[model samples]
Target: MSIETWLAFFVACWLISLSPGAGAVASMASGMNYGFARGYWNALGLQLALVLQIVIVAAGVGALLATSALAFALIKWFGVLYLLYLAIRQWRAPAQTMTLEHRPIGRPLSLVLRGFVINFSNPKAIIFILAVLPQFLDPGRPMLMQYLIMAVTMVAVDLVVMAGYTGLAAKALRLLNSPQQQRLLNRSFGVMFGVAAGLLATVRRV
Candidate 1:
């Protein structure tokens, strides 16, 4: 890719990372419950999922999945169900001060898996990759190298953006000192998760 092309793709990546979605909700919720240092696991998991999605796109599986109505529907519904489950858990979460000592989000493995599933199951991501990635590709150049560059750019941008979201939420955790305020914050995040799930469910194949 030429410098101009790479620059354009880089800009697109930042814009993509900035777009609000279920992944952002998950990051903020995790950060709200867990401090930024620990909450970072969720961000890491999300970047991993982003890598997988990029690989799927590069391998052409994304095109197949995008074209397959049944497959797309199945994945979409599973993502919606999983987000709804997260919403329920968040709603019922006990009020507690944010502390690295009291980690209620679950084991590191669970948190990572939760983050992975949040993005991996979203068909919209696969579809977006199928639709958008090719626009930045150079057929005459090495496909794998180009894909790698694109993936790295996306992961780097998203990691920074997600960390910022997590940080802000974690900072808010300090101000929510009272039990009532904590409960309200938890419930608000729960509602955001539920709303994201609903938005995912309503996504149409186009």
Candidate 2:
């Protein structure tokens, strides 16, 4: 990729990362419930999921996934159902403050897995990458290098954005000392997740 092309992709990455979706909702929820230090693990897992999607795109399977209505529909429904599950879990979670040692046993792995699953289930991710990443490719340059640059840019942007979401939620939770207030905050996130699911379910392949 040329410097100019890479720059454009970088800008696009910022917008994509900043868009509210299941990943963003999960990041904020984790931060609110797990604290930033622990919440960051989920962010890392989300990066891993992004890596997987990029790989699928780079390998050309993403095109097939995006074009195949059966595959796309299957993954779309899975994402919608999974988001609903997360929404219910968030709504039912007990109100409490988060601390370093306060997480449940094995919660770290659970958080990471949750992040991975949320990202991986979104068929739109692969489709979006397939639709967008190719526009910046330089036929004259090494394709592998171009893919690497794009992947790095995306991961870097998403990491920072997700961290911000997590940190902001963690900070907001600090003032929510009462159970009632925490419960309200939790339900709001749950509602956000439901909205994200609705949006995901309505997505159409381009």
Q: What is the C-alpha RMSD of each candidate to the true structure, in Å?
A: 1.4, 1.7
TM-score of each: 0.96, 0.94
What candidate 1 gets wrong by more than 4 Å, as runs, is 99-106
Q: Write the per-residue lDDT of candidate 2 for residues 89-196, one digit (tens) a residue.
A: 888988765444554333778888889989998898998899899999988989888898899899999999999999998777557757788789889989999999
Q: Which numbered prediction scores highest in lDDT against the true structure? A: 1
lDDT accuracy of residue 18 in candidate 1: 94
lDDT for each residue of candidate 1 in 1-206, tens digit (9 for 90 to 100): 88899999999998999999999999999887877877878988898898999999888899899899999999999999999999999999988665545545546677788899999999999899889889999999999999999998899999999999999988886676577887898899899999999999999998
